[model samples]
Target: MKMDLGDQGLAGNAAAGGRPLAIEARGLIKRFDHFTAVDGVDLAVPEGAIYGILGPNGAGKTTTLRMLLGIIDPDAGLRRILGAERPHDVAHAIGYLPEERGLYPAMKAYEAIAFVGALRGLPLAEGRKRGKALLEEHGLGYAIDRQIRQLSKGMAQQVQILGTLVHEPRLVIFDEPFSGLDALNQGKLEKMIRGLAEKGTTVIFSTHVIAHAERLCDEVAIIAGGRVPFAGPVDLARDRIRPQVRLETRAEDGAWRTALPADARREGRFWNFTLPESGIEPLLRALIEGEAGILSLSIERAGLHDAFVAIAGEAAARALEEGETEERA
Candidate 1:
């Protein structure tokens, strides 16, 4: 019988409930020779959440993930995956896509996918059956029998991802999954990640790109300089920074100038400034009382990038921006 790769039933049957924490780590520390890579990190990933570990390159994201998967031992700290203190025993229940991509050039796409499932103790026949269905579902049905070397980069990546999901692991971890894809492929990946979460799978991904986390994560951890400076709901991170206000006025008299705070900067007819703690009401009242005819006013909520700069400092933020710029170019 052909399996339904689009079946949401996988989540219904395997979804974790009541157990609030799917992954937990306390005071995790890792060092390589003399260099301390991960220092005193704590993480609490809620069950079934789309969690993100966000940071620039060399931020210890890979190290932390390696520790969590038991691929490497932490110098200090404790971690639990799926309620098991030791990840090795329950390793089969987890699916991981590493930062590095590797596939045998001569291997057929379907066989390569099935091979990954076999590593997780799945029957080869069953793995191949599901692999074909998953490929078809992800718009790669024609590539099922194609050699890995013969496929395009995006098609190869899609096959690899299908391999990661063929076994239907409860927890899926992706490290820089969007690194090489174009905008359209990135959008497709984002949709796929959301679909996994809707089916009750706990998805955790690490990326330097803030936009992906902003659009997809329920909670995120901001790692900088080998330490996690911030971790919580996405809203809480944004809440730490004040909203920006942009106001354009028809009147540019002294009264209009006086109404704005000292920090306000005028560019053309628009006054751009950060909202003060006293809030927008006071500013609006002052502007109206001074007869500054407000042509337009807009309040822009702080986004993940703003929050990152506020919390992780400008250097880290700059790295992220530069990385994005390079990708675009």
Candidate 2:
């Protein structure tokens, strides 16, 4: 979807939900031995916004998420989660779903959820009650008593997701949450994320998939080579590239062709080019006056995928494609 190109603000002001930041990180760095995984990363996520950390596999997305969650201390830099400088201090208020999905095969669906909640300080009984309600609400009530191994892959994944929310956390961080789901399940997950944001829960998710971020995120950070190249509102990223113009005319050659920019490319009867800085009015006037016989004319704002390619460079974009291919395989 194309958003109107507006102010070039990062996640602040209205973009930050007019509330305090739920997460703030500055110059976060993580290293493994001599290998640097995340370098000089920074992020500002609002209290009730859905923010996405976008990058390909091996781009330090997971490492960055781990740093934010306090699962692993950053070798350098600082971070604050849910207004606490120490993420552990706010552990009970946060929910995390790691990229690696796991659930004891022998545990029943509701039991598994309660176990996870217990780890986060939610009482087992309360968790079970919430778990059953969540399952029924999400159309999984029939699977409530079934063991994890007995459920389908999609069902198991859903169970784990429910477990993540069983404690009703104020902040949720999901690393590559859509990694292995089918189309239907992916849609469900997207809806769930939106629901959380609607209820004033802050959500931060890392993913290589651009479509999800484009559709759901209010602000995003485009990371490449273990660093962020751009971080701001989705519309700002899209505005990095000018809107494209698609024009179909009956005339093969005329003064209208002269008015078209030199960068315009002709494909049969269609002429395509970047919308001129002077806008489409001048171009339309020229076409009409020159009798170009316009059959169709439309302006298309760049999508998030195109904006990502423009901001992250072709190499990083290619890496993202390769990651998607591997996921499919």
Candidate 3:
């Protein structure tokens, strides 16, 4: 039976871009004995978007995902998946790839994909057919008949990813999806995610790697210390701080230096600072009149890494760095 989720107004009716949400959670809490693994976490994943859950290891990302998938019920709060209050009721429309990946080592690649599809109610024959086609499209056709144990580590991961899609789920959730893949395979996975969103599939993946989220996600939730410090469009997060300015000049000291912001620092012959609130035009005029030989001037917006530090604090950011170091190891 579907439990009443009450009013959904808290998470809002739609995403900042006006797209309908595929997943909505409000004040979600989970506990393990006396340990509170997740504390009042909330998420709003827009439909047909590439959403990212970003954090360090053990920041409750996995626990929150489990709750969203209905693998475990939250101790408090509520969620809706694909318009259903009960996530399992719409299980047919969801695909999940957990952080702990496993497959029958003895099973053939194609058969493994088909088996996964069968678990989601797809007919075996059709699943096999689709699985073979998917492998071919992904350049794994030669491995279709190869046993899972016979394939390289990267190939095995590719097969598992294909299995997740063989059932053609409307919403796909991945927990630390890039955990074990090398750079090449990671790039391949990023491309695959973009393809899914192009086909109107909603894809949510959790990762500690900020670059992947920075490149691929439409919106993201930054989870740290078991709570979300930031959520919504990726640009909005970066926009919390001003764009950085880099000015290269032939003049080392001139009247133009006075026009530079108070925070401006001299780095050899260059001036680096945050763009001032009054904007750059006045600064440009000052530079020209003062004969400060401008070699080059550029403005760069803050990237997600910088935004994450600014929003989630240095401690959480350090945890993120340590998690990344461990992943690299």
Top-scoring candidate (TM-score) = 3
Tell me the tens digit of each residue's lDDT in model 2 across 97-173. Answer: 99999999999999999999999999999999999999999999999999999999879989999999999999999
**lDDT sort, best first:** 3, 2, 1
lDDT of 3: 0.91
TM-score per prediction, in order, is 0.89, 0.92, 0.94
lDDT of each: 0.87, 0.90, 0.91
**How close to the true structure is residue 325 of candidate 1, measured as C-alpha lDDT?**
78
Number of colliding residue pairs in each model: 0, 0, 0
Q: For all the candidates, what are their Cα RMSDs to the real structure?
A: 7.9, 5.9, 2.1
**Candidate 2 residue pairs in backbone clash:** none
Q: Give the TM-score of candidate 1.
A: 0.89
**TM-score quality measure for candidate 2:** 0.92
Off by over 4 Å in 3: 1-13
- Pick by TM-score: 1 or 3, better one: 3
